[model samples]
Target: MAKVIEVDPEGLRSWIGSAKRTLTIESEAMARLIQALDGPLGRAFGEAIRLIKQGSGRVIMTGMGKSGHIARKIAATLASTGTPSFFVHPAEASHGDLGMIGRDDIIIMISNSGETAELRAVLDYAKRFQVKMIGLTSRADSTLSHHADVALCLPDCREACPIGMAPTTSTMLQLAIGDALALALLEDRGFNAAQFKTFHPGGLLGAALTHVKDFMHKASQLPLVAPTTPMAEALVTMTQKSFGCLGVVDGESGELIGIFTDGDLRRHMSRDLIDLTVSDVMTRTPRTIVSDTLASEALEILNSTKITSLFVVDDKNRPVGLVHVHDLLRHGVQ
Candidate 1:
């Protein structure tokens, strides 16, 4: 058995107040960063983008302490988007990692104060090797900025910490800048979702981008019947295929002319369903999708039309495949 401690209302109120104040301060800092982006900061960003895009080499990100963590994330974002990039520890660069930096590669060095000791070795190496360096720092006059090919000076803003020492607000601004650069490069390179999917497979994103043809039932699995086939035979084909529907194609032209679904069966319950031909019971001009259509798009069709399955056809409207909502759901597509 555990003893329940009495709650302190006053203490809890103070904690909430502190948290709100921290959020307000950080929010204001981000607002200021947005304003700074419209000024000289925007120009510096443009220059960085131009240099990185024009170069054939990758972006080498390096930083110290908290900035190092931010740099690693920025590198990952850049790499996944379109621009190739990787993070190298400043201290590690001094101990043989400098070999990773090629002459064509550009270095993005992050330092809030622009005077990190470990970063000096990387700066010196960049200078010696003639590698382009972009410095992200608050102080424009600091050593890092002095040696940089392009100095992206951060706005003059204090940390959100109560003591004004911790890296709350500054790190937020750094991350915002990094994100801005990555998105800018992504747009400039025309990185479409298909290209992004290649790098982001094996997750919800991969499922969303998966093409219909990838998981759709191919021709052999499709429950297909000639337009002249009896409804009884078509029902058997539909049952055996287990897709709850049968595509009606013209035997002469091999073109899909109609579809017979379970819903159609219900609507014709008053008629002699078994003796009828598929052409008499089927719904003409049924909804269809192409083989290259995305599974997500097919889901949209199923949702909008209030149907469970769709016929996957070719350019000539020949039924090449069939896709069910269950197929999309089973493939982890929503």
Candidate 2:
């Protein structure tokens, strides 16, 4: 790799200015793309959607080079948003990956010039497999678009690169078109946030937005101690449960009367812990949340109060489960 030369601040500023001017040009180009969404493009979009709705198998997206990257992103977006879609590298199609596509699948191929030699194999495979084809290309008259069932003709736009060599504006248009397709499919399928969580459950944003009931320990998992219980046994109860706390319940009614936390244990260190009863040390009516609460609301309580856990209760203040900070952490909560 060649080393970059250090230049004056003003010299760097001029290059940055040129980049900004290029972005303005791209923005204008995107606006023109919307304006160019005339009768033909609308018909193509409608036909593509009809094909997708009628199809039973997945959507197979393929493209060459940078268009391939955009195609892969579109495939991922579609897959995660309830539309069954996957990417097949056009170059690899010639190398036996073409066998992975099925006749029931709809082939969506992308290319800027729409004349990649490698993509030709996938185009051929589409015909051989009897798969319907949709072309996302700038040139409507290009080979890839000519034989397609639907052609999403991109507007002829200048590149955002200073030399007009990079795939900036075209890639953006492809990505925007993919987004439009995905959202249209999402609405058609009636995809909801709950369904979205099923696809994206490995992140803090997913956990934080999830329902508290999903992570709360319930039934036999709950650790409850009667308020009349000795502090000596309550200490063991709180420790064994590993919740750093114990729900102090009514011996007869089984209703949560108080809570004995690790902090509460510390407060009573001055007293003989073994001699004191949970009734004497436990704090009455500790912080609690209903089972119907959202994890986001629980997170707000945890963050603002800097508390590690909350007691899960019923409408009548009966202990149903225990929610811990560790449980949230395990579920990818922030």
* Model 2, span 1-334: residue lDDT tens: 9999989999999989998998898899889777777767777888889999999999999988899999999999999999999999888788989988999999999999989888889887788767899999999899988989899998899988878899999999999989989999899989977788788776676786688888799987777888778877888877788878888889787788988888877777974788988888888878899886778788778888877888889888888887887777777776
For candidate 1, lDDT tens digit of each residue in 11-85? Answer: 999999999988999898888888988998888888998889878899999999999999999999999998899
* Model 2 alpha-carbon drift over 4 Å, by segment: 1-7, 34-40, 201-214, 219-297, 304-309, 313-318
Q: Tally clashes: model 2.
A: 0
Write out the backbone clash pairs for model 1.
none
lDDT of 2 at 72: 96
Best candidate per lDDT, number? 1
What is the C-alpha local distance difference test score of each model?
A: 0.91, 0.86
TM-scores, all candidates, are 0.90, 0.72
Local lDDT at 188 for model 1: 85
Checking candidate 2 for backbone clashes, the offending pairs are none
**Full-model lDDT, candidate 2:** 0.86
